[model samples]
Target chain A: MHLERLDFRLQLRALIRKELQQILRDRQLIFLLFAMPILQLFIYGFALSPEVDRLRLGIVDHAGSSISRALAASLVVNGVFEVEESGGTEAQLARKVQDGQLDAGLIIPADLERRYRSGQKTRVQVLIDGVDANTAGIASGYVGQILAAFNRQLTTGTQLPGELVAPQITFAYNPGLISSWFFVPGVIALVLNLVSTLVSSAALVREKDSGTLEQLLMTPVSSLQILLAKIVPLSFLLMITVFVALMVAFLVFHVPFRGNLLLFLFVSFLAILVGISIGIALAAYSENQRQSLLTSFFVNLPVIQLSGAIAPLESMPEIFQWMSLLNPLRYYVSCVRAIILKGVGLEEIWPNVLALAAYALILLSLSSSRFRKQLK
Target chain B: MRRVFSQVTKEIAQFRRDRLTLALAFFLPFVALLLYGYATRLESKNIPVAVKSYDTGTLSRAYIDTLFATNQLVPARFRGSDIMGPLDEGEAKAAIIIPAQFSREVAQGRVADIQVVIDASDVNNARVIKNCVIAAGNYFARSRDIARGRQLIVPQVRLWFNPGRDEALYVAPGAIAVILWIFPCLLAALAMSREKEQGTILQLYVSSITSFELVLGKALAYTLIALAQAVLLIAASMALFGLRLVGDPFMFVLSLVVFLASSVLFGTFAGTRASTQSAAVQLVATTGFTTALLLSGFLYPLRNITYPLSLISNILPARYFVEECRNAFVRGADFASQLYIPLALSSCALFLYLVTSNILRKMQLKG
Candidate 1:
């Protein structure tokens, strides 16, 4: 029995060494496994922001009064809108907007200063290109706020009752509201998913396509042992990716790591396990590398979308909100965000941790069972 | 030309035999359309805000009522005086604390201050929350003033193009662009690399088919497949999201054809460069998928992308295609005004085709 155990150890070690060598020898795979994640990290961190700014504005100041100029000036002062054209008819402004030269046009009427001086309510027309709905909504909101503030300034000290209620806003966790702090954690989850699932499934499918799995099965190693060997090395490599990504998030993006380091690593390890199991299940279901890749893409896209990695969960409809509960990546993202940004402990993130652990266990068991059956 | 046609027929035969690829080619785009249309809501709603009021006065209650009236910020329940509890526990995205004597101060004609603490971990959501809270406050004050019968300057806002702010109208066109680019590029790349991976390119090297004919053959087959994909996705968008062709269909169709050809040829180029199917797919995924999704102005506007990155976006075919699609579906601009998009698309297609053929010729010479 002692000799048998020793032999088992020897076989497992050999299998792991072989897997490592195969992975390391592929220069392209190594680049993809390591460099791509960092590259994507920087690109997404810098490029992706929902904050709307620098919209092109066209002003048709028919009034040509100081108030009209001040109103138009206020819009550009905040840098939300840039004055692209200041002197044009409303028709010309509309034409420019249609030609995609301007994002919005503000028309000040001819009687603007006269109406205001006479204490009669004045009306100004603001035409916004609403093809991009989100930007238009935000721009309109800005216009509303600016107009309200302008009204207050116009009516000040004239028995116009002051605002009875005011809100003092304070942003917690990230005082500056850095977008990268939010995106980096999500990117970490994304990178982990890509490496663990795509690479592992491709590795396995490539073996099956080359008929190496059958040859390996001809040996004395158990199917479970072979699977373990493949998973162990892949998980080690994925951990390195997670580490490098975390470093980039810290050094480059200045993403604060507030939670316990050990806890973050543990959660990431579970996430990697979940990813590898998903890849294994995909490999078991596909006949070739192409099919596996296509299937993975089909599966990964929805999972990533529903995970709230890019889009927020509260904004989704109720059904999808509930459906996101089933996605394991959701838990990973929540845990990472809570740990890194909120600096919450296991006590706060226990539910997410439990969910991730359950997913890792269940998926690993189901995929390994299917894989073992296929091997037999 | 006849050799290219026969090669196309051979490639189609191979494509049809792969039932999974065939199903994926048709089904994946449909799924992506559904997901992007329904699941992605840039307009944030139903943000949970914990409202902790220290006063039980009618004015404070009315203020709280007005806050939740918009339904943009929903009230979250919390048990304690700790305003930060719900935020830390992730139960609420923000917290509103109404100080004591708030209603009295307002009744005494002094301004009442309400403290709002927001979790800015998600910066965009935090910004939305801040705006919602402030808007609610402004609404409260404005309504009070209106009750008192005061005149105010009103801005008549007109939302042109998409007056209803229908998110699907904005999202669907971008989705179609991204879906078309990713799948065709992926399919073409895989098809190109599969021959090299299996050592079947050697046969082509020995055959009488010129390198141009071979590349043209593969490009034609995949473009045909992508054309079908484009039709199915556009139809699905129309049915699912109530998307309609708002302008002349000529520019949209012409640009779409060139766009698909360019994407497929781009894939073919990547396939020529990468020696294996996985490598080609990876190449497409990392470059093709990422750029098409991010830089193509799919979710965020092109203006949001800063310099250097914006420069990269200028070269991406998906960016121009997305612009043309948005114009076709939403803006309904004139055909002459939108002519530059198709021209840009054709130039991209020509460049990709030339590069792909050149690479194929080089491979033949080496062989």
Candidate 2:
């Protein structure tokens, strides 16, 4: 028994050493493992503030009056839209739109000042490209509302001003609509995937590269032992990577962690293991590095959509939502967001935990079988 | 003409024998559609909500009852809890905290504001729930006043963009980007991987097929495919949806050319690096499919990330394509000109080609 235990320990240690040597040897693997994540974190966190502001607009004031210029000035003062150039003809504004030089344009018709003086209703045409419907929609409506509100204040009509005014709009949750809240959690899930999915495939490719894979088969190490040895070390490395990532998110990105740290760790562990196992299983059949990377893409591409990381599951048509159930990342990401951001405990997050655990066990076992079969 | 025809026929026969290629070519679009349809919907309906009622009085009870009557909540998954559990688990989007003094405040004709604690993790979901919560509150106010024979609440002007919300104009340009990313990868994946399979890729070094020639030939093939796919996709989208060609098609195609050039160049790099068909497929999915969808600011905006990472998105050809396509097709951007996305994409294509050539020259036959 003592000899067997020692033998097992030696095998496990040897397998881990082999995996590490292969990963460290390759410069590309090093970049994928370390540089990519760090670069993305810094680049995405600092530079990419999705808070939509500073829209560039081209304006053509047909009347060329003080009122229109004053209106344009209010838009700039609000910091919502910037007038890149002050004066442009109607055709020039049209040209700007065509040239992609402008996000929007304001064309004040010939009689804007006259219309305001006559106390008559005037319609301002806001032309927008329907492509990128969301941005266009938001910009056009915001400009329209702001201008109309300015108009409303000036013209107190037959209907009382207060009556025409709607109840004040209060955006809850993210009142300012900070896009980071949407991106950060999704990125955390994705970055974790980089560790499990990307690394597992690379690790398998490394074994294939170094020729230790066939050598291991020549030895008496159980396929399951080899699989566990390969996974546990990588999982440890990934856990450290994930922890560091979370910390960066916490400190630098200001991504809040409201739940139990230990529970979060446990849940993330299960999720990462499942991803690694799936990658390992896929990697087992690959004959070369190219094949393994291809496996990673085919497997990982579907996961992004299937995981409810972007789309709300319920909103998806029934066939698609059912398809989402197969995505283990969906459960893991849900659990991560719940625990880390929302501070939900095991009681609420248990469903995801159970699903993830099941996934991990199934995937690891399947990968072990594939490894055994491949070796044979 | 006959020799060229026979060569083309031979290529066709070669393609027919490779079941993987056939299967992928046929099934990829269907797969993409299903994936996009299921994965990318931003709309949130049937948002789950948990209601904790501390209100037992008639007015408060009426409000609670009206809340249940609202459309936004999926159903009460949990009965009552303080702010944490349900929202934390995403079991409920909003927790309506109806306080004990609720009826008394209403009877006194004073404004009683019940706090609605929402899980703000999902901004869009939270927005929908907030709308529902407001509506429920308004319903309570209207009902309470109606009982006393008073007109308490009235509808008001909500200045929305385009006046009427149009969904068609929104999805067209993204489709153009999607086509640009996929078509080139398919054609380029085949060209490089095929050469590797046939042992002819090595002949580039033997013969004088410059690295530029290889990239250009492979890219030219895929560019044709991307162009064809663009026409079909654009025509189809416009036909299915009333997507008018408000902008210049020429500008759209020009931007697409830049996008495809970059994507095809990437495929060449990927195909060369890959030792097998599966790896080529995987590389496309990872670099082409995944990055194009997410990092390119297509499905989600690049601005959502921190600076330098979002800048990395600039290298993603689809980012430029999405921007330029949206400008031309939906925004009615002039076809004759537009510089930014095209310039960026051309630079990226040039860079990728240079890297492809450099790497190709240094290519090792074995990994």
Candidate 3:
């Protein structure tokens, strides 16, 4: 009996060692796995952004008054805005904004001269498409701020000649618009999902590919125990890798070290388990390494979509909101954010802990059952 | 259990020479974190425009000159006399006219008017222009009235959540999920794809292994890896970005489980359909990426889109993830309120498992 246990351990260890060798041997995969994420991070920092700047501007003035002309000049002269188009009907202008051809349009009424002469405030409507709330919202705000400044100019009227107008305004979190701060942390969350899943999924599947899975199965070991052993090494290895990644993210990216590391570690511990179990389950399910990788990719979409990493959760319909509950990434993001930003303890993040643990349980239990069924 | 250990050792021994497999297992997380951190963002930039000013006086000159000075547009140079010509020729956004009498009228305390002609070709750009104008004009008028001793003018405006109007502020929170979601899912989906490419899938099927076992094994292995990577990524993010999470971590993890399931299901399901590993990877990755970005309410919110289109967003998992993450991290909502998301996800996972297992079983026999 003791000899049997020793033999079992020997076999399991051998498999782990073999698995490690296979991964290390694939230089292309290692490069792809690591290089791809870093490249993507750079792209994200450079390209995809909600910030709208340098809008094409169009102006139409009918008053023919010196005042009308002067005003048009001031509108575009502001560094914050740019002059693009100059002539068209309101209907025609509306069509331009509708077609996605232009970002902003300006109309100076024909009676613009009359409004100023009669001293009656001319009401000019600024229209905006609410489709892209982010861009639309920003454009609208910029226009408002600039206009408020202009109001001050007009208050010192030509006739009245000497009063300043100022509007009350306030700025919120990330007042300076530092894109790095916003993206660095987000990238940390995104990168881990790819790294952990990719590596873990390939491990067990490789065993099956190498003609070792059946050999292991033939042994007298229970399927569940075999599965548990399979997860142990990979789990241990991944935990260390994650720590390295985190260290890189901090040391290399200089992202921000505001949150409590202890809270983060606790959450990381639970989240890592869930991720590892998912990988194990995939390995158990896959007949080949290719299948395991492909399976992981196929599942990427729904996870990202339901997680609210890119879009507003409330903005999405209620149904989709319910669907996202399954994405472990959402919870990871939440936990990461809490640890990084709030530096909260387990009590504060317990809900996330429980959720991650539950997810790990589900993945582990199901995979184990599947393994048992496979054994049968 | 003793036999199991022996088997594990044997499995480990059979592949000691394969270094590629081991390298990916531990090093992939850092790579993924760095890539996703840099790839995602809103695509919008530099618009071109032409300007024509009709006004000759100081005020009109000030206005038209201001238009040219705006950085958002690439300004076209023109004389005041050519205002209409530039506009008609489609060379300018709008031609501004300042009556020869503009300055005198304002000095005399009379209402002075200005007309702006806009090109309606680009609807959105036109609106942006209009917004800029009304805003600029109101400012000019407010102070002008005070100087002339005319009726005081006060305009009341209402603002929403982002008073500073920073678009990134709103995007920052959402981007966390939008960019991060792809990791677990894409990784899970790819795991099986890679195994198929390596010719390992066939060997696993010949054994007495059930489809459920196969799927579970794949899912668990990948999940473990994903969790580790997530930890590192999270740590990196917190250390570098200072992004705070005010909500429950449990809720966040719960959401991730659903995301992983959907990602793997697609891969597993796609594998059943595709004949080759490359084909599976291409098909699954494309579908996953497109669906999440376009339909999952990431770039565009359902509420802002057409109702019918919004309805389509319902079937997408990203939609819920976005909301749930926001609720979990931002609002700190309780587990009960969040229960609905997990319930829906679990059901989906179950459905995927059933379908995948059935198909795999069929494929195992036929292939």
Candidate 4:
């Protein structure tokens, strides 16, 4: 029995060494494993911001008065809108908007200053391009807020007999609202998900495609040991990627790692296992690498979408929100976000931890069974 | 010409034989469409906010009522005096604490301070929460002022193009652009890399067909497949999202053809560059798919993308194609006004085809 155990270890070690050598020899795989995550981290951290700013505003100041100019000036003061072209007719501004050169246009009427001074309610027309419904909504809201502030300034020192409620808003966790802090954790989850599934499945599918799996199966080594040999090395490599990604998030993006280090790694490992299991299942089902990749894409896209990695779960419909409950990545993202951002421990995120663990356990067993069947 | 035609036929035959890939090409986009249409809502709605009212008075209750009245925030249950507990536990995104003024300060015409603590982990969602809560506060204050008779400058705002602000109108076209770019590029890249991997490109090298003919043949075949994908996706979008062509159909059709050709050529370029199918897939995913999704102004506006990255978007064909798709579907502007979009798309197609053919010609020479 001791000799059999020794033999098993020798075989597993050999398989792992072979896998590592193959991975190192493939420059593209090495790049995909290490470099892609950091590159994606930088791109997503810097470029992907939902905070709307610097909209191109076309001004048609027909009034040509100080108040009208002051109104347009106020919109530009906050850097929300930059006056691309000023002192044009409303028709000209509309044409610019139609041509997609401008995001919105503010038309100041000829009597705007006159009407305001005479205490008659003045109306200004703000035309917004609503093709991007999100930006357009935010722009209109911003215009409303600016106009409200302007109105408050105009109506200041006037005697009004009413109560005022002041809401003192304080942003916790991330006071500065650094978008990268929000995205980096999510991107880390996304990169890990993509790499784990694609690399693991491709590794297995390549073996199957080249008829090497059959060669390996003819050996005395158990299929379980073979699968373990494959999974262990891949997981070790993926964990290193996680470390690299986390370092980038910390050093470059300044994303705070507020929770327990061990807990975070454990959860991340669970998430990676979930990804690998799904990949192995896909590899076992697919006959070739091409089909494996296409199938992985088919699986990965919805997983990423429903994970609340890119878009928030609160924003999704009720059905999708409930559906996200079934997504393992959702639990991972929630845990990661809580740990990194909110500085919560396992106590706070135990449910997510449990869910992730369950997924890892269930998927690992299922995929291993399928893999063993395929080997036989 | 006959060589190119025969090559096209050969590719289509292989593609048809791969029933799995053929089904996925049609089905995956439909899944993406459904997900993008329903799942990708940037607008934060029904954010859970834990409201801790220390004052059980009428005014505080009314203030709480006013907060939830907009339906942007809903009350979340939290235990004890720990205001941050719910937020920390991920049960609520924000917490509202009403101090024990007993409505005395507000009744006395003083500003009643309500402390609002928000989880700004998601900066975008936090911004929405802050805006919603402040708006609710402002409304409450303004209504009181209005009770005493006061009016300010009321700006009449008009939402042009998409007045209803339907999200599907914006998302469906962008989804089409993204789906079209990713799948076709992926398919073509795989096709090219498969030949290289299987050592079949040597046959092409020995054949009388010129490098240009081989590239064109492959591109034409994939372009036809991509065209079918476009038709199916467009038809699906219309059926699913109730989308109709609002602008010049001819401009839309022209841009779609140009965009598909560019995407397919791009795939072939990556395939030719990468030695392995995995490498090609990686190339397409990292460059083609991510850029098409992010920098193409599919989810975020182009203006919102910061500098340096914005420069990358300028060269991306997907960006221009998405613009044209949105124009055709939502804005419905005059064809003349949006003429530069198709021009830019066609230029991109021409550039990609030229670069791909150059790569193929060099490969042929080396062989």
Candidate 5:
């Protein structure tokens, strides 16, 4: 058997050309690669609003007086609660909440107004559905605010024999709590991670499964050449898709790019490298396309979960917090949020930037070595 | 019956060969549940705050102490005239400013202003901090009111089904249902599509067994495997997260069987529609799991969502199953109370089975 010397430039070019041809021919996948980001961007953008408005509130007003009616009106005044039914029993309200008709319900004592008139301590009950705990917690907070405001009004122009500590609130960065400001950067990182991983892994795993890798092996092209060919076009395609996703974030969500454009692009390039490496590594590990896809799903979700996009890292257990340090998505999310929201530069976000670079380098080398071993 | 039995043995044999797929089906849920269990918690406790106290009097100190007592906000480092500086730098999420007149104003029964500067870049955290600040102020006022022989209007918040609002308790049950739905569906979704891509479908056509037999055999094998996965997940949930079967044991198991059967059937249905194994894989990963996660009202309340979107959630079988699981495990609901969801799930499963079997038969006849 005679072995010819490897020609790096010629072999890589041919392999890349072949991969690009395959990508272009697979119209369904190309469409999926582009369309999935835009679809998810719109779906998550509109669907995921943290600002809880118009909660269904059932009122049980046993007081039956002007004061009680005024309290109920105050609850419904700010478009926070649309009054479902007034003057219902607590049992009726519980039934309504249990049956999914009302998200929450309020019960007023029979002597609420009388107690207010007589200068005695009184209480009002707010029952929240605990099924969706996040919404329930927020709704409970809103109820607190509503009641505090009512308490002030209830004692207005009258003397209260105690210290009244008034709290003045000031919100920075986003005063109105526009959820899009929070979601846009997160969606960008998530979309880039997803599209790049799926496309890159599918690219290589398809070749391996279809016996095309054997055809490439018949040539002088080495395993390294084949791996580069697989990653390069997908990385370039990922860059274009990410650029389009950033355009959506800017135009549709109106999230401004506050930091240096070059810095942002450089950081995105690092993130895309991380994504492609995971994809290639997952592809190298699996025998076929089905295995690769399932393995990638297992890998991607944990990366996102530990990334602190949806929840704060501080809130998580100490061990998961440590585990998040290894997650490339965590640094990507942190850097993007800092650049867009805080308008911080490289000096402020160098650690995260370095982390992304380190992750890309480490993951790329590991996956390349694994791919070479699989080739053997 | 013998044909079906042989098919089951063949599937189990194939399943044994692929240790990776077997490990994924058996164990990915445990990892996913652990990650999501810690990751999806929305409660913002131990949030750092900066205190700029212009009033070092006893009243001001007491007020700051009251804020700390909630255990929601902890004091962090802050040094600057502008409170926004530290907040923008991410040193602290909130800052409290106690005015010099705090002691005097409170002593005279006058309204005293204590400013809380919140970084609202994270809206959820901001809202939680704002509420905590308000509650702290109210507690201070109510304590003083009781001392001064004054009346206070106390507000009681009662949370049903989940009293203490433990995040793990809320996430575990839903995570189990999602795990049961996703893993088996993925494995079964691939069975038919893999055969098509590998030309085994042609081999099946040349054989004497009918397409109904093939589809039925595949479904039965996977249904058994999924049932095993269900048991593993339930045990994991209980052992790891302290999830208990508060309702009838038989009813919960029944619900689990129904949900598992329907999910695998749905996967089989998706397989028939897909032309390639990759497409079916994508269907399981992106479409099936995402539909179950987002549309099932697992994380968010369905009632709060508006008309058309709410209507769309009704069509997803996972929605009913998640509700059923929560009802059985958390609410301790009985069979009589939860009859409708099981019936609905069974109908969906039967519908998908009939559709998939028909498609398989049609493909066989054409071949």
Candidate 6:
């Protein structure tokens, strides 16, 4: 029994060594393992900001008075709205917006100053393109805020001679509404998913495509040991990437980590497992490297959408909401958001934890079984 | 010429036999289009909100009525002081706290503030909610002003092209760019790398086939397939997502052909450098995928991005394509208006194809 155990240990060491040598030899793989994560970190950290600013505004001022000009000037003061073109006809302004040259148009009626002075309400029109639903919605909101502030200025000290209602707004958690803070958590989920998914499948299928996998199978290692050997090196590389991503999130983006460190680590590992399992399952089913790649794209596109990465779970259509329940990314994304942003513990995020665990279990088992069958 | 024709024919036959590659080439673009179209909805409507009204007064009721009427907020009753319970459970995104003195203060013409506590976990969603809440408050305040026989300045908002502010218009064409980018590039990158990895590239080198003929043959075959996919995606976007082709159809097709040629040329460049399928895949994913997602201005406007990122955006072909698509689809801009973009695109295509062919021919001379 002791000799047999010793023999098993020896075989395991050889398998691991072989895997490591292969990984180190491929300069491209090493680059994928290191440079890709760091590049993505910088890309997402610097490039993508959810905060909408500097929207192009078209103006048509038929009022031709100080009040109408003041409104336009006030809208531009916040730096969120930039006046692209001024003093155009309303139809011309609308055409500019339709042509995608401008995002929004403001139309001040001809009788605006006359009506305001005569104790009659005058409506000023603000038209915005809604093609980009998020930007459109936010632009409209910014317009509202600008209007409310303008109304307050009209009512406050210089005194418009009329009372206006103003809402006292308090933004909980992130008061500044920093786009990076929101993105950091999603970025963590995304970087980890991309690394784990691409690396695990690519590493496994590379061996098969090169015929090294068959030779490795001929050795004393069990099918499970070979599978474990295949994943362990790649997963370790992926874990290093996770650390890199976290460092970038904390140090560069300055995303706050209010939750327990240990819990965050634990949940992240669960997310990594989820990525690896799905990748391996796809790899096992695919006959070649290219097929596996196409499969990965097919799976990843849906996974990203269902994960509530960009489109919130609350916003997706009803059937898609149901589909999101099965997406591991959904649970991981929500869990990380809750942990990082809300600083909630496992008690609050248990559903996501349970779902992630379930995904790992089912995917790991399914892929391993398929792998074993193929080996036989 | 004969060698090139025979090589092209061989490539066409191989492509047909590869069922998986063919399916991915012909079918995946539509699938990706449908998925992205259905998934990306930017309009923030029907936000679940908790109404914590302490005052049972007509003014407070009016405020609540105005909030619901905007169609932005969907009110759910907050059970007493446990407002955080609904918010923590993700049932409500925001809570409107009307203090007990709300009616009294409003009635007496005093500044009565409605406390809007927002869960700003998602910055994008939070902005939408905050704006809606403020708009609702302003609407109520205006009603009060009119009640007192005062003049108010109201703003009327209008949206054009995508008047309904449908996200499909924003996402569908962008999705087409993404789909075209991935499949065609991968197909071309893998075409040559597959030869190398299978040791068939050595056989081609040994045979009488010149390097120019080989590169042109593969490029032509893949370009035709990619062009077909592009057309399918364009048609699918129109039929399903209502993408209006308002510009010159001829110019649109010309721009597409130019864009596809540039992409395939870049793919050939990557394929020639990489000796294995895995390396080629890695190269394409890192360079192609990352550039498309990051530098293409697909997700956000190029102008708002910082100096370095904006500079990077200039080098990527997808940025120009996305811009041209928006102009064509929305503004119906003529060829003269977008002349420089296609010109730049075709020049890049010509340059890359020349470089790739030169490199391959040099290798042929060496062998």
Each model's RMSD to truth, in Å?
A: 1.9, 6.1, 20.1, 2.0, 3.6, 2.9
Residues A1-376, model 2: lDDT tens digits: 9999999989889878877776678666565556555545654445334344566777777777887777667667777677777246767766665565665677667787787787554555555533344455445545644554455345445233222102233333345555555556666777677657777877776677669787878789987777777788788877777777787777776776778999988988987888788778767877765556544545766787677665556656567778878888888888877776667689877888999899889988888787778767
TM-score of chain B of 5: 0.93
TM-score of 4: 0.96
Residue B216: error of model 4 in Å?
A: 1.5
Q: Model 6: clashing residue pairs?
A: A124-B154, A124-B155, A124-B156, A125-B156, A126-B156, A126-B157, A126-B158, A127-B158, A130-B165, A133-B42
Stretches of model 3 off by over 4 angstroms after superposition: A1-14, A64-80, A87-99, A129-131, A156-173, A219-229, A240-254, B1-367
Model 4: which docking level applies? medium
> What is the iRMSD of the candidate numbered 2?
6.7
Instruction: Note the Cα lDDT for every prediction shown.
Output: 0.87, 0.64, 0.54, 0.87, 0.79, 0.78
What digit string (tens of lDDT, one per residue) describes model 2 on residues B1-367? 3433443354455655755454444445445544663345554556776766577888876776776674546666664345555655566676666677778877765667676777666665554555566556655665665332222111122212223434344444575577568756765776688788768767656764555555666666566555666666666666655556665666666667878778878887888888755456655754576566656666544555455556667677887787776666555655446666678888998998899877876763332
Query: Alpha carbon lDDT of residue A297, candidate 6?
Result: 73
TM-score of 6: 0.92
The TM-score obtained by chain A of candidate 4 when compared with the true chain A: 0.94
Model 4, A218-275: lDDT tens per residue? 8898999889988999999999999999999999989888889999999999999999
TM-score of chain B of 4: 0.95
lDDT of 2 at A255: 71
TM-score of chain A as modeled in candidate 1? 0.95
The candidate that wins on DockQ is 1
| Model 1 misplaced stretches (Cα beyond 4 Å) | A159-162, B79-81, B146-151, B365-367
| TM-score of predicted chain A against the true chain A, for each candidate | 0.95, 0.86, 0.80, 0.94, 0.90, 0.91
Better of 2 and 5 by lDDT: 5
Better of 1 and 4 by lDDT: 1
Instruction: Supply candidate 6's per-residue lDDT for A3.
Output: 98
TM-score to true structure, per model: 0.97, 0.77, 0.51, 0.96, 0.91, 0.92
Rank order (by DockQ, best first) = 1, 4, 6, 5, 2, 3
Model 6: lDDT of residue B43: 48
